[model samples]
Target: MQKSVRLKSFELVAGDIRDVDVELLHALSISVRWPHRPKDWELFRRAGHGIVAVDGIGRVFGSAMWFPQGDNFATVGLVITTPRAQAQGGGRWLMDQILEQCGNRNLALNATHAAYPLYVSLGFTSEAIVYMRQGEVQQTLPALPTLGGELNELPSDRLTEITALDERAVGTNRARLLALLAKDASIATLSRGGEVVGYSMRREFGRGFVIGPIVAQNAWDAVHLTAVHLKNLEGRFTRVDTRERDGVFAEFLQRSGLGVAETVTTMSKGRRFLNREDKNPWVYGLAGHALN
Candidate 1:
């Protein structure tokens, strides 16, 4: 399809799809391959969802979904547009559909350097800055805090506690989106006695891994969980995208031998979701973009 010089009219079809090939999606030039492979979309679709865009011929051009989070918050993510379908109202169409469906939640996205301009133009504001780190694994990392929190792998029956804790740490929780979170492999938790405190999750990002929703007592709590999780994968060079408030996590990353690969501005549109009272923190690692 030829790019439209100007979109005279735009249309969007609102719905959900669980199976999106992140590699194929990137191959279409809808996204950049920071880590390609659709690991999280399955879970996002299983939860609650929002919008998808299709051309007049009824083929998917690009897509976006507004995922539900606890505390009545929602996040917009899994956004993509095909190269053959670019500039012909695909992006704008998906945007309109998502904004309308998002319905006043504090929407969030871990944006790429290329897409920040479009996000700003669409009325999303950066709540925090994120710096991505790439390349080889460092030989040493900051020690995990003992912090008196008992650590345990999440059990299948107790996932609700983990999800509930996620809402407490972050404004929203994407527990409903990915079925894998409920699975034994991708989940871990930290607590005191039986009381749930913090949790961590990992999903394959292309060939490597990405850590998210590493919720904890605070930034320190989350970082502790993050390090413990990363330690399990010490030899792998994983990509971590975290929303920064202060320089705490960034410093921790630097000490671990990681550098700032890229900086992203997390933007939101519509009403600000007010689940968490405090604004700033050291840094926030996403559980999943679809979940916020």
Candidate 2:
């Protein structure tokens, strides 16, 4: 018998991401040094639809997911391709499938440095820079401004209280996504003059906990909202994704020991995806990179 026979080249095909085993998806992500865990994959699956690139033997080589926000907007993410397959046009193929599935809906995504050129070539416009911050929470948090409102715990059942505010900040009605997040997240809201002004959620993610979807009107409010969760997360690994480059909110995260771990570019196609105005609610912290 011949030993060590060379195998013939295999063709890649698109498959439903949900059909693959979670472990395979986990391995595919691990191959790229991504921090996503199996649980993260499950959450993303529940939140959106995706496709995986696989060969005849069922080995996954790449994946792409798009989350619909309302009827006309969507966010594309989890676009990954094995290093060995990147130069073989696997990434672009996966994206073409995603774009086709997303239809004519305006699309948005956060692109890593390696993936930036591909997205640009696909006609995505630069929008903003997102700072990926993570580290052990400080035992002592930095000084925060005087609480201008009442900070109170929000039961997951009362998710409606924040949906409108969240929609205002993200420009979409992500009630379904927020409801899914609230199922496992410890939620807090700031109230002033008998009105809910801001909110934040702390939940278990990749390595530890992530505090995010933090919606507020100003940096001071954002600081107070974040501190409410950091106080309890002292000395534990925590991550926060935000587009804030400077100001009180960004400074607060640095002071709390969550330094910038990496950066990703926020890009959009079709219509503008990010728009900020003074004295209006804004996304101080993102729910997740994929969810954005």
**Number of the top-ranking candidate, with lDDT as the measure:** 2
Q: What are the TM-scores, per candidate, against the unseen true structure? A: 0.75, 0.96
Error of 1 at 243 (Å): 1.9
Query: What shift in Å separates residue 273 of candidate 2 from its native position after superposition?
Result: 0.6
For residues 231-253, write the lDDT of model 2, one tens digit per residue.
99999999999999988999999
The most accurate candidate by TM-score is 2
Give me the runs in candidate 2 sitting further than 4 Å from their true place: 1-8
Model 2: lDDT of residue 150: 96
**lDDT against the true structure, each candidate:** 0.60, 0.92
lDDT of 1 by residue, 86-181 (tens): 656567767776676766665677666656777888877776666666555566777655566776776566677766565565544556543455
